[model samples]
Target: MAESAIEVLGVVRPVAQVRHMECGVVLRASDAVALTRAIGADELLLRVVQRVYLLEQRCATLSAALDALGASLRQPRAQAGAPNAAPLEPADASGVASEADAPQRAQQVVRCAAFPRTLEKRATDTLHERGFLVRPSNYDALACLVYMHGFYCVGVATKEDFGGALWEKPRTASDRAEGPSEQKRARAVHGSQQLSEDGGGAAVEAAAHNDSAATRMRQTSAPVCRAYYKLKELGSRELVAFSDCSVAIDVGASPGGWTSYLAERGCSKIIAIDPAELRQTEPPPPCVEHLRQKLQDALPGLLQRKGLAADLYCCDMNAAPSLVVELFTQAVPLLKPGAQVVLTFKNVYPKKRVWEAERDAQLDRLRSVADDVHLVQLFANTPRECTVLCRAKQSTEQ
Candidate 1:
């Protein structure tokens, strides 16, 4: 039977050689003339097989690079006393050990790798064969360098990576025995090809790197709830009057997170207002009263009816600061003699300025409306935003 024409089209190289099923080189074909001339069907097939093997080898190398890069970025820094290091237990019930006996945590490892293109299943298989474990994990790009080579070289030191920790979970018995089904394998290969066609492997690697870096940042930073606790602590000492028997108004209060914090701090009552509905998994604190209306519209009427005012008005509405300032000014008259306001101003304007200048300008504007204004920029554990704590002056004549 005549051999089928195996088109060696679009591959990196045009010249191809064939190897038999038993690994013997049967023939070499550089072009059409060489392919057709004197080759029997079996020999021609062998030549195609050799070319495929070479191509697969090249692909395997590329895949290894990709995996290494990913591992480096995802791997966490090693600490000296971490589980992987020398084990030592505390002698006391408090879980505190004598300074002399404590083992220092190891420093984090840094390693990196790069791939020319997205890898297919075959590439992953090759990596496994080459002694690289399939780490079912993800990582950021910058950290990639540290993970691949760090631990192996440093032998474990004590320092946490700011990015995040790496978790290595061993595969289950079932997972080790099972391979992806044909359909899934095909889909993965197709996906890799698509990624390569659309933006190439480098772009995909870059995105994965960025995502991992961002994840690390989030993990290391304090949560919003924690930030509130920290703020309460700060206010208790530096500005004790700010929280003393205070009546507060929380704008855009949904989920009542901030409102709950204020309530816990012994605020007299909090008029929680938001256009959106509050979704509370548990009953709200007794001090909070939910009001369903926009702050700009509802605050004026609510203030007029009360005749007296809130001690602290906290605006966290996801709206423009200028508009928020206007609404706050309108509601200012309703505040008690020495009320204070805490608001967050998101920089939604087209132009950007230095952080100090922007904060100062906002404080200056507030001073114009109130008898006394004090502004403190609270560096909350959030990115791209800060808290502005303002105090209203008390009239001395009254």
Candidate 2:
């Protein structure tokens, strides 16, 4: 069909068959460092990239191919300095690397500002007919492919270069829309997946790197700040079972959104601890007890007095994960045996090491005091974070 279309237009198709197709990938600009490290270890990718990458084939095909290569896709990572700067290769265990290294090359960029409606529809349909997965043109994925390939041919006109084409007169919406006859083609191609919403970018980037930003928006519509969505998802998934449990200690609980969520969820008592002032809610939910002191400082005293033993512990500290783990480690003895701990391990700070390094380091610290550590990328989390749900191991068991 593609050949027929070109022939009908008196145009010649490129003779070279695509032995390997390049796919674009988008990641959280934040977790790029660690995710890059993981991608480096995998051999399936023709080339790994930051904002986008070139996969050898569809994600499913690559996974199978990866198995044959004795490798698997790890999340891609990024360099610490500039956003556009080339990322460094992973270092050895001791934070050291051999001096002999090749420098990274400059990347070509593609910006698809506009394209004609007929061309867009034909390209979409042809690719779908050939079983070639193309991320929607709007997504960063297709743009990456266009950047790497130089020009992505869509329909009537083949864009020769990125800069000139992107700066050309923008096509009107009606000019961009599929004609009545071609609308089915548009829908057919769209059936594969949407790059911006769900596609290779989400599969490799979010599943490998982090989750969607849309998740937070979709899961909640509360008046509270975005932080409220995190706790709301935690409970909705039964990840923490806050409603099933009676007492929950919320560390780093400023803004009181979690407290409010807990109160609404029917948690009998919520001890919200933070140094910052919490926003006052009307009638102030009776179950929430705001403690305006640092959890590290206040929790230890509570432990000393043997006054607080909670069924669950939760923290969403903006501090380093290691520090949060340390504070919680000391307070583990104050938690009821087999109580749950739900926390967010965030890549909130700049790091010299990969994200796994920080996550493993924190988990190591937590293991000494707690157990059953499972790190999950929640729908509510952005690319920079993950939710950790664990239980305080029975003192006698571990």
- In order, what lDDT does every prediction score? 0.43, 0.48
Residue 281: error of model 1 in Å?
3.5
lDDT of 1 by residue, 208-315 (tens): 332444345434422223234324544644653554646888877764556766776788788889866654435656677888888767865785674557787777
lDDT per residue, candidate 2, 1-398, as tens digits?
11111111122222342322223332223333234334433222211222222222111222222221111111112221222232222222432212123222322112211121223344344333433344323222132111112233210111221112121212112222322234333443343222321112221222211113323323433335446667777766667777567888889887666666777788888888998877646768788888889876786567775556788888888877887787677667678888989888888666647777988888877776777888888655656788888888788343
After superposition, the stretches of candidate 1 with alpha carbons farther than 4 Å from their true spots are 1-243, 304-307, 354-360, 371-377, 381-383, 396-398
- Cα TM-score of candidate 2: 0.46
Q: What are the RMSDs of all candidates, in order?
A: 23.5, 19.6
TM-score of each: 0.46, 0.46
| Index of the highest-lDDT prediction | 2
